[model samples]
Target: MNLALLFGEDFVSAEQAVLTGRRLAHLKSVLKVAEGSVVPVGLVNGDIGTGHVLQLTDTQATLQVELPEPPPSPLPLTMVLAMPRPKMFRRVLQTCATLGVKDIWLINSYKVEKSFWQTPWLSEENLRENMVLGLEQARDTLMPRVHIRKLFKPFVEDELPALLKNTHALVAHPGTGTPCPVHINAPATLCIGPEGGFIPYEVEKLVEAGCEAVHLGRRILRVETAVPVLVSRLFDACS
Candidate 1:
């Protein structure tokens, strides 16, 4: 539940804040929060607090709350992803949010299905919803900024450099190399390909644009799968 939405007069303590919105119902019905319970409380863009249930009425609930420790910072990576199918896009967006990507670019690719572009899930509202789900799941409030690029070369040759001002740029491709290097101390820009992966020409253009082409071994993973794998593997390597 969003702490900003909690309302009432007697909610003086962290335990007295009552929730009456959809979240309250979810907790009472699904989570089975009982009277005198203390649950996780958080501000919309602030630290997590404790919600102590002082009273529970059919229409309202109260708690005592305070925001203490701050939420963790976002991962220092900018993800450049080729637009996948609509369903795939939803998953990818959420995953990117949970992984704390600094930014996301939904770029066009040579292998991108023309019909996939027509999916309504690409609409702003739908995309935002997926990102919210991802943030909530990860206990993160900040949303990653997202971009769209329908053209390939123009984006790589023109816009990418500025976007990646101080970031180390890398593109995820399949083959052999030292494997995507472990997370470095600095921020990074990672480019992932379309379903069948980036064509050689597309890869070459990106390489010329200052992004190093890196591999994840021989196994070609789906776009949705490659993302988290790369994020964790690279970050863990550096950690």
Candidate 2:
């Protein structure tokens, strides 16, 4: 964990917090910290800062926290994606958070299995857990929001158009005519399909909804691989 993400429950006072469970283990074993040691820390959906160890024990570690700086700027992109395989979903969610993607939509597609949505990772607790892991890895405090849309047509026809308003919208399909735009660095909404790519009908619907279909050359990447590649191409994070 690059940052110790503290929640409201972790705090004893305005400037103090306690670490336990995985974070406590990491402190004792991985970081090998002691009383008086300092570590990077951040409050969930708050700010990034430092925590000075005040007390340590097997059960918990108490810290004096100082939160003065804001977290990393979020990418100005809304990701609409087909639900990936259960095994890959958690990692993909985490990857999205780490990459500064604040808005994510998991939508259905022709190739997406009905069973994919049954995964426990979609639970509110699990979702927060994975997102927290991602935030910790990125040393970012702002939490990402995930929206689920199991019905394809209703969402595309009913909701997607307004979402695309005033933003460059694109769908990533390998054989499409236009290449995915590079470093546009502006607000955008990107639609990516399932494992075998979107059926022609789905692509057409997305296109009709204002997304210009685009490509990332000949490579057929999995959903997990495609997301980061497409995001990086769309914006320069360093800027």
Best by lDDT: 2
Q: CA lDDT, every prediction? A: 0.76, 0.94
Off by over 4 Å in 1: 1-22, 54-64, 176-178, 237-239
Candidate 1 root-mean-square deviation in Å: 4.0
| Estimated TM-score for each candidate | 0.83, 0.98
**Clash number by candidate, in order:** 19, 0
Give the poorly placed runs of model 2, Cα more than 4 Å off: none
Which lDDT tens digits does candidate 1 get at residues 169-231? 889989737478876746888999998889999988988888888898888999899999888
Candidate 2 achieves a global lDDT of 0.94
lDDT of 2 by residue, 39-65 (tens): 999999999999999999989999999
Model 2 residue 18 lDDT?
93
